[model samples]
Target: MTSVLPRTKVSDVLFSCCQLLDISVKWTIQYDSPPKYPHYDPGTSRQLLCDQCPPGSYVKQHCTATSPTQCAPCPDQYYAEEWNSNDECQYCSAVCKELQYVKQECTSTQNRVCECVEGRYLELEFCLKHTECPPGFGVAQPGTPESDAVCKKCPEGFFSNETSSKAACLKHTNCSALGFKIALKGNAVRDNVCQENTDTTPQKCGIDVTLCEEALFRFAVPTQLTPNWLNILADSLPGTKVSTENIERIKQRHSSQEQTFQLLKLWKQQNKEQDMVKKIIQDIDLCENSVLKHIGHPNLTFEHLNTLMASLPGKKVGKEDIERTMKLCQPTEQVLKLLNLWRIKNGDQDTIKGLMYGLKHLKTYHFPKRTIQSLKKVIKFLHRFTMYRLYQKLFLEMIGNQVKSVKVRCV
Candidate 1:
C-alpha cells in the first residue's frame, strides 16, 4: 500500500475534489447576487429580467439595454402596494354601503377600508343592527364592530324591565332594607313593589281590572278615532286634565294603539270606575246628534241597508228579491231597490222602526242588544246632538261593557 496508490483510486479522489470546488463556487455566486425583481421583456421576445417598480408606483416603460425602467407614482384613487411590473396602477374601487362608513381612507399604496356605523356590526360583508335584549333579559357584553351584543337571562334577584342593547340587569329593590314591607314580589320583568309596614289593608279592586283592560283593548280608539277626537276624550276625563305635553310624550313613546291604551289606563287610575262609565255614557249621548246630522238620514246609510238585506228572512224577502238586490251595481241603488221591495211586502212597516224590528227577529243577526238599544236611543233623540257628537256617542256606547259582544255590522 505504501509503495504506490492505484491510478483508478487517485483519479476518483481528484474527481470528488473538482465537484466540491464547483459547488462551492456556485453557492458563493448565488449568496452574493442581488435579489431578482419582477420583470417583463417588452417586445424583445427573449428571456430577459428587467427592474420592477416599487410600491405606490407603476412601470411606465420597461428597461432597455441602455436605460433603467421608467416608473410613475399612482394618481388619486389608485394604488400599487407591491413591487410590480404592472403597466398601470389598480383603481381604489372599494365603496362603503348603507349604514357604513370609511374606517381607513384610501391612499396611493393601499385600498379603502370600511366599518359599520354606530349601533351596528359586520356580518358576512354586510352591516346589521346589534341584537337588543328583550324584557326579562339584559346585555352581558356590548356590541363591537366585529361582534354582536351578548345577552343573558336576568338571574334571581335581578330584573330588566325594558328591551335594550346596552343596559345590564338591575338588582331588585330590597323592601326590607328600605324599612318597608314588600307589597308585591319581584320578578325578572318587574321590580318589587313596596309599601309602608303600617299599611296592611289589601288594595281595592277597580272595575274588574281584567275586564276593563279587555274592554279598553277592544275599543281600538287610536285606529277608529282621529287626534282631535282623542284630545276631546282627554279633556272629558273627570280629574286633572291631560296636558298637551303628556299627550305628546305618550304619542312619542308608544305606537298609536299603545298611546290610547296608556292614556285609558292613566285615566282609570285617576277616576272611580262608576264615574268613568257614567261620563263615557254622557259623552256618547252628546255625540249621537252629531252623527245623525252628518249622515243626513235617520234610518241608516248604504252599509246599514246591506246588513239589513243580508239578515232579512228568506221567506219574507224571497230569493228573487235578494238576487235583484245583489245584481244592482251601485250600493245606493241596491239599497233603494231592497227598500222598495220591503215596502211592497209590508205597507205600514217599511220605516226604520220596522227595519229594526225585522233585524231583531233574525236569529243570525250580528248586532248585539246593546247596539239595538243604542240605535233605538239615537232614533228617540233625533232632536239633540251634532253629527260628530252622535258618531262619537255611538262608538263610545259600542265600546262599553258590551264591547266584546259588538261587531261592525254596518262598516
Candidate 2:
C-alpha cells in the first residue's frame, strides 16, 4: 500500500509486518536497492475459504482449496460432538444393552447399529408373538428356545388349563363346594378346565315305567291305601270323583302359564341387556319350576313339594322355589286327581281360584317319548273337566273383577 509520513523505522516496520498476515519478519525492504515485494508463485500456492456445515452437524475440519467440503463427515462410532467446528469424531454413548444396540452413531461411521433385546431373537426388529399350547392342555416337560414343550393332559382335582405366552400354564376351575360327583373325571376343554365333579346329586340311571298296575289303577281304591295314595289307584282325574269346577280352574291356570312362557321366550330372543335378561330369566324360572312342581307326579304324590313350599319362609318363597319343589310331585296322574277332588268339594270362588292358580304349576315330567302318551292321557282326562264355567264365574272377578284379587293357587 502506502508509506506513512515519517517513513517507518525497523521496529515500526516489524510491528506493521505482524498486521499483514502474509508479511513475515523474513521479508524486508532494501535501503539502497530498489524496493520489491515478496510474492508466491501462482501455480505453487493457493488461498482457501471455508463454508460452515449445514444445520444438524458440526464440521470436523476446515476446508482448503485442495479439499471440496473442507470438513468430511464425522467418523462411525462417533458424531460431531460440538457446534461450529470439530476436529475429531466423538464415540457413541454407552446407553445400549448387550446384543441390544449398535452405535446409532457408528463407532467408526455415520450412524449407530441396532441389536435385538436380551434373551430374544430379533424378528422385524422386535420381539414378536409367543408360542402357545392348545386349550384344555398345557406344555409338558419344559419350554425352550428351539423347541416348545409338548401338550399334556391335566390331572383330576387340579388342572393347568390354558397354554399362554407365559412360561407357565394357567390354573382352571375347581370342584370345592360344588357337591359334584366326578363322572369320568372331567377333562380340560379348549384352554379351559372341565369342572372335576359335574353332578350336583346322583340320580337313578333309568327305570321302566309301564302303566300303573291294574290293581293300583282299578280296585286299589279306598280301604286299600292311605288318603294320599287314593289317587294312585286311578289314571284319569274325571274317574277320581273330584270337583268339576276346580278341575277346570287348573286348565285355565296352565293356559295362562303357557302364554307367559311364550312371551318370555320372545323377550329372550329380542336380546335385551344382561341385567334385564337376568330378571326376565328369573321370572321364567319361577314359572317353569312351578309348572313342574304342580304337574309332576312324583310317587303319584306332591306331598313332599307341598311340605317343602310350606316350610319355606314367607319372605323367601319366590315363585322359583315354589315351582322347583312342585316338580318333586312326580306326575300329573296324581295332580289331576287332587285337582278334580278340590273342584268337586269347593265350588266356592276362592277354592276355584286356588285350583286355577295351582294348575299353573303343572309341568310335564321329562321322561321317555312313550311317557308323552301317558301325559296326553292325563292332559286329556283333565281337559274333560272344562273350567269354562269357573272361568266364566271367575271371569267377573279378574276377568270379571280386578286382577289383584285373584286367589293364590296354593293358598
Candidate 3:
C-alpha cells in the first residue's frame, strides 16, 4: 500500500494473501441469463407461469410470485370435470321426462344420467313401452333401459300360447313320456293336450253322436255340398269315397236340414273309425265363408269379430284360419261369417257372455282400457235390449193382448 504497484501485481498480491489466510473462495461464471416465464404479467409487462386449478374446481384468482392460485369446488347442480382456469362451473342440464327416471344423480364432477322406467325402453330421446310378442312368436331378447325387446317366430317343437314381452317359446309337452295319449297334437302356438288312454277299440273312439248331430244341424248347409267340398271330404277320409253325384241327388230330394243330416250320416257310416264328428267339423271349417254368410247380425261389426277371434283358445283356431282372416279384403262380410263359424265351433253359447270374456282377456294384454270399456258398454246395451223384448212379450202374454213392438234408441 505504501508503494503504488501496477494493477496486475496488486491482484496477484491479494490472491496470495487470501491463500495464506487458509479460507476457501469460489467463483461462479454465468454464460447467459435464465429464460422468462411463458405467462404474461399485465402490471409489470413481464412473463410469468401461474399454477393451474385441479379437477372439480375452478380458479378464482391467478397465481403470483408471493401467493398460489385460488380455487373453489363446484356448487350443487354444477360440475367441472377437468383442470381449468374458468371462474364458474357448468350447470347440469339433463332432465328426465315421462316414463323416465334418473339413473345417476348429478355430482360436482359429473352430469346426470337418465334411463327408462320398468317395462319401457329409450328411443328417439323418449321412453316407450316394451313390445310384446304375440301368440306363435317368442321373446328372442329381453328389453333394457336403452333398447327395445326383440321377437322371433316360434320354431317347430316349440310353442308360445300367449302374448308376452319377456317369456320365451316353450317345448311342447310329450304326452307319451307322461303316460298319456295325445288327444290333440301340438303345433307352434299350442301345447299337446294329453288324455288318459281309456278306449281299446279304434272304431268306437269318437266324439258324442248327439253333439255331432247338433253341430251338423247348426253349421252344415246345402250350399256346402259342392264338388270341391265333396272332394275335400273324400281326401280327409282315405278309406271312404264321397260321390258328388250321390250328394247332388240327396240335396235335390230332401230339405236343406235333412239333406245336411243325411250326408253327414252317410259319411259317418262309411268311416269305420267313426271319428265322423271330428272329421265333419274339420271339413266344415274348410268352408268357413259359407257358414259365416248364412248367419248375420246387423249390430256387430268386424272390429268386434276381430276381438272375439283374438280371444279364442289358441288350439281352437288353425294356422290357415289366422292367415285367411289377415288377407280378407271384404272385412265386413268375412268378419260376420267368421263370427258365425266361431259360434258353431264354440257350441252356440251366449254371444254376449263370450264377447265379455273375450274383452276381459284382451284388456289384460292387448287393447286399451278405454276401448275395452266402450265395447263392454255396447254389449250391455244389446243385452238390455234383448231382455226388454223378452219382458215385453211376457207382459203381453199375461194380459192376453197382442205383442206390440217398441222402438229403442241407444245413445
Candidate 4:
C-alpha cells in the first residue's frame, strides 16, 4: 500500500525541435526507495512482543509488540505498583484481611498469599493447610503450641505447674518425713518435685537442730545461728522457754528445777504468737559475728558453756548427744580453757548469763521446722533459773580434753 514516485531530468532538445535541427535530447528517470525501518528509541523498553515472562513474574497479556518477551507481574502483597503488559500484577504489601496471616512479602507488582491465623489450620484447596480441629475434652490431651496436645487430669497431690505445659500433674510421693505429709504438690506430680514432705521429726528429740540448723538457715546468718544464740534453739525442745522474767532469774541458777519453770512460761507466749516466732527467728539472723577477740578478757570462745546450759533441763538433749556435738567446734580445748578462766574471775558473777549472750552467734539455727509441740517445759525451766558460771567449768571438765580438734573456718 505504500509507494515512492519516479523522477526524470530533461536536456537541451528545445532549440533543435523549434528550428527543425536534428539535435537529440536525453531523459533520465530516478526512483525513490521506501522509508527505512524505524531505529529503536533510546528511552524505549528493550522488550520483545513474543518474549516469555522473566523470573518472579508471569505473563498477563500477550505481546502486540514486535517481541513477546516483554511481560510484567502483579505487585507482591497488596501495595504493588502498576506495570506495562503485565499479566499477573506486581505484588504490594497489604494488611492481611480478616482470616489470613502474612505468609509472604509483596513485591513492587504483586500481593502475597495470607495464611490463616493459628487456631485455624489452612485448607489446601482454598488455602495451603487444613482448618484447626476443635479442642477435645476428657478424651483429648492438653492443648499445645502445635495444635492440641492430649489433655489429662492432674495427678493426686499434684496440680498444674505451668499454664503452657501439656502434661497432667504427676502423682505425689507416697511417704513423707515423720510428723508431716505432702498437702499439695506444685506442677505435674509425675516428677519428684510433686510435693515436699511437710513434717521433719525424728524418733525422739528434734533432729540435732542445734547442730542441724547451721546447715539449713545458712543464707541470712552465714557462719552464725539465729538470734537468742542458743535460746532460739529452744523451739525444737518442745516445751522449752526463756521468758523475759525468768530469763534473768535462771541466768542466776544452775539447778534442774529452776530451769524448767521459766522456759515453760516463755514457750507459752512465743508458741501462740506466729508473728513473734517469725520475728524471733529473724532477730537471731540479725546478730553480729564479732571476731573472737577478748578485749580485757580471754581470747577463747565460751560457746560450749552456752550450749551446755541450754543442754540442761533434760527435756531434750541427752548428755552424750549434747556433749559430742559441741565438742566438734574448732579450737576446742583453747576455747574451753579460756571460757573457764573468764567464768571464774569475771566480776565475781559465776553464771552462764554473760556466756549465753557472748555465744549468741550460733543461736538461730537451733530448731528444726516443726519440732515444738509445746516448748513451755524447757523454756519455762530456763526462765526460772540463772546459769551459774560453774556450769561452764563443769561442762569443760565433763567434755574436758576429750574434745576433738577442728580447723578454723567461717562456718
Candidate 5:
C-alpha cells in the first residue's frame, strides 16, 4: 500500500517544499553586494588633508572644501619653537637690553641673545666697564665682549703719557737741537729731560780766523831780509845817531821779514800744502749741488743719498747721523770747519780719510725721518720756485708773441 501512491504526486510535493525553503531564507536574512561609487566629503573636495604644522609656523585656519591648510609666520621677538597646532606664536624668553647689542637676532626658530659692543665688557649678568691702556704701555689689541683690553710695554726710546687706545709710544725729545743738554737720558717710560746752558759767551768760533788771516797776510808781503841786516837789528848801538840808525835798520829788517813771510805763504798755497788744504776747501760751496757732486750724482735728487746710505752696514741711520750731517753743512761760510774740529777731537786720521772717501763716492746715505721731511720741504720749496720762474717766462713769451703779431699786422 505505501508504494501505491501516484509518482506524479510525489515529485510535485518534493519540488514545492524546496521552493518554500529558498523564499524564507531570502526574506528573513539579507546579503549585500559591493558599493557602486567611492566615498567622498564636501569639506575636503576629495583632496587629502595635511598633517600638523612644522616649527616656526602656526595654523591660521582649517581646510575647506576647495582649500588646503592655511599657515602664518611667527612674529618678531616670538617663536613657535616646535611643530605645533597653536594659533599664535610664543613670546621670547630673553629680553632686549639697553647696555648691549644683539648677538643673535630673533627668528621664528631661534631666540634672541645679547652681548657688549666695543669699548665695553660683560659682567656676570650684564655688560660692565672696559679697561684702558695705561701710561708707558700701548694697546696691542682692542677690547671686546669676550676679551679684556690687551696692552704691551713701550719700546726703547718711546713713551706714552696717558691712558689711550689710539696713540702709540712717541719718540723722546731731542734736547741737543734747542741748545740744551740732556739732564736725564730717555727711557721707554720717560722722555729726555733737558737743561739750558747758563753761559752766554760763544764756546767756539764758526770759522778759524787765524787760518784766514795767515792766508790773506802771506799774499800781501814781497821781499826777503838779509842775514847781516838781521844781525845789526839784533845788536844794540852806543851813540844816539848810531842807535837811531840801528832802530831804522831794525824797522827795515822787520819790514823785509814780513814781505818774505807773505811771499812764502803764497808759494805754499800754490804748492797745496797740507796745512793750507782746509782753507782751500773752505772756498768751495757745500750746498745741495756740492753735496751731490761729492756723492758723485750731481744731477740726481735726494733719493740718491738714501740709496748710498743703505749700502752701509746699518741700512737706517739714527738722529745722530742727521745731527752730524747738519753740523757739516749748516755753516755755509766754512766748508771743513766741522771736519777739522772732529779730527782735532778724535784724531782718527784713518776714519777721517774714509769719511772723505765715502763723501767722494757715488752712494746714498740713510737719514732720520725728520731730516728726510726737512729735505722734502726744501725740495717742495725749490719746486715751487722753479714753477714760479717757468710761469713768469711763459707769460713773457706770450706777451712777446702778441706784440710781434700786432707789429706784423701794423706793418
Candidate 6:
C-alpha cells in the first residue's frame, strides 16, 4: 500500500518544520504577500489620492475609496496659483484706469467693482474726464463718480468768464457805491471795470459857498429845523456839520434887521424852488430806477438779497436777525415790500421825495395792517443820525450782491 499523508494547512507546515529543527521552539508568523493597499514614501514618491492639488490647479473631484484626486488648471481671469484644498479658482481683482479707483474689492468668488476718482466722472464701463462749465455758463449741479456735471446759462446781471467745476455765476460790478465811475459795463460773461471819480472834490454841492450857506440855513435855524429831517440831511451831505461856529457865522451874516428880512425872503423862495427841484429829482430817480430795472436788478432777487442779508461782515443789520425776520414774513406781499422798505429805509435819500420813491415799486394790494405799521417804523429809521453808518454799510452790502466774485477779480 502507498503511504498515506495527513492533510495539513500552510500555517501548520511552518510550525511542524520548526518543531523538527529544535527540541523546544517558539514561532512567530510572517506573511510574504503584498499588503491590501499601496504604500509610498512621502519624501520621494508621487502624491497619493489624499494629497492636495498643487499650485495653478484646483480640485475637480474629491478623492474616493477607489480613485485618486482629480484636478484642473485655473481658467482665464481666474487663478489658484498656490497649493490649496479649494473647490474652485479665485476671480481676478479689478485693474482700474488712471482716472478711476476700486469701489468694491474682489473676493474669491466675486469680481471687483470700480468708480471714477475725484475730479473725474464715470461714463458706462469706463471712466471719462469731467468738463468744466465754460464762460457764460454756471453750474446747475456738481459732478459725481457716477454722473456727469450739469450746466446752465447765467441769468441777466450774472457772469462767468473762466472754466470751473461747480462755481455759481458771479454778479456784475457796482460802480456807484464804490465812489468810482464805470469804465466798462458788465455783461453775462465779463465784469465791470471801475475808474476814479473825477467829479468835485468837496462832496457837498461841488464846492459852492452859496449852496453851503443855503444848506446851513435850511438845516440849522431852530424856527425852520425839524431835528429828524435836519439830521438825515446832514448825513446825506457827506461833509456838512452841525456846530456852534457855523451857527455863529449864520447869526453874524443876518445881524442887520434888513439882512434878516432878506434871508427870510430867500428861505421862502428856496422852499418854492425845492418843490420845483423835486420834480426834476423825481425824474432823475426814475431814470436811475429804469437802469436797474432794465438789467433785471440782477442783485435784487430773493436769493441774492437773502445771501446778502445773511453774510454781511459787520453788525449794521444783524444778519441772523434779518434772516429770521425774512422767514417770519414769507409767503405774502409783505416779503417783497419789506425788502423794498429795507432798501429805502437804509438808503441815504437826499430829499423826502426820494425817500418815498420806493413806494411805487412796492405791491401794497395784499399788505396787512401790521405791514403798514412796520413801514412807519422803517420810515422812522430812515430819519435818524444813529442809522447813518448802518445805512452806508447796508448800501455797500447791496453793492456787493451786485458785484463780481472776489476770486475772479483777484485771479
| Top candidate, metric TM-score | 3
Cα lDDT of model 4 by residue, 1-411, tens digit: 986444322223343233211100110112132112222333355433243333334444455434433333223242323223335544454475666667776643345656665544434423222222222212135342234344455544544333332333433333232112444433442222212222322212111122112211221121332234224323333323443433433444433322332343244333534554444334322321111121112222344344433532323333454345345434423333333333333322222344444334334535321212112222222233232222223223322242212111111
| Clashes per candidate (backbone, < 3 Å) | 14, 44, 1, 110, 8, 0
**1-411, model 6: which lDDT tens digit per residue?**
897556676556655344323311211122232112232434545534354555445667655555655555555566554555678888786497767788876542245667888877877676776668999998888888888788889889878877888776776655554445677888878867654454622221111112112222222223332324323322332222333332333343332222322233233223323453344334424433332232222223344344433322222334454555545433332233333334323432222233244333333333233433443444453444543443334323322432212111000
- Worst window of 10 by summed lDDT in candidate 4: 22-31
**Which segments of model 5 are wrong by more than 4 Å?**
1-55, 58-73, 80-90, 93-95, 101-105, 155-159, 166-186, 190-411
Which consecutive 10 residues in model 6 have the weakest lDDT in total?
402-411
The better-scoring model by TM-score among 1 and 4 is 1
Q: Candidate 3 on 142-224: residue-level lDDT in tens? A: 99988899999999988887898998887775555433478899888887775544453121222222222333342333233
Per-residue lDDT value at 15 in model 1: 67
User: How well does candidate 3 score on lDDT at residue 252?
Assistant: 42
Tens digits of per-residue lDDT for model 1, 183-206 = 799999887876545443121211
Q: What TM-score, computed on C-alpha atoms, does each candidate reach? A: 0.35, 0.24, 0.37, 0.26, 0.28, 0.27
Quick one: best lDDT, which candidate? Answer: 1
| TM-score result, candidate 5 | 0.28
> What's the C-alpha lDDT at position 149 in model 3?
94
Error of 3 at 298 (Å): 46
In model 2, what lDDT does residue 294 have? Answer: 40
Evaluate model 3: give its TM-score. 0.37
lDDT of 5 by residue, 1-411 (tens): 466658998887665445434433443354342112222436556744443344566667655556545556666567766655577878776765668888888877677767886677777766766666788987777777766677788888777676885455666755554344677897866777655433531213232222222223222222333544323322311111222332332343334534333223223333333443343334322233333223222232334343433322312443354345444443331223333333323321222232334343432444344433443343343334443344334323423432222211000
Model 5: per-residue Cα lDDT at residue 386: 46
At residue 298, what lDDT does model 1 achieve?
Answer: 34
Give the better candidate number (4 or 6) by lDDT: 6
TM-score of 4: 0.26
Off by over 4 Å in 3: 1-55, 64-67, 82-85, 199-411
Model 2 weakest lDDT span, ten residues long? 206-215
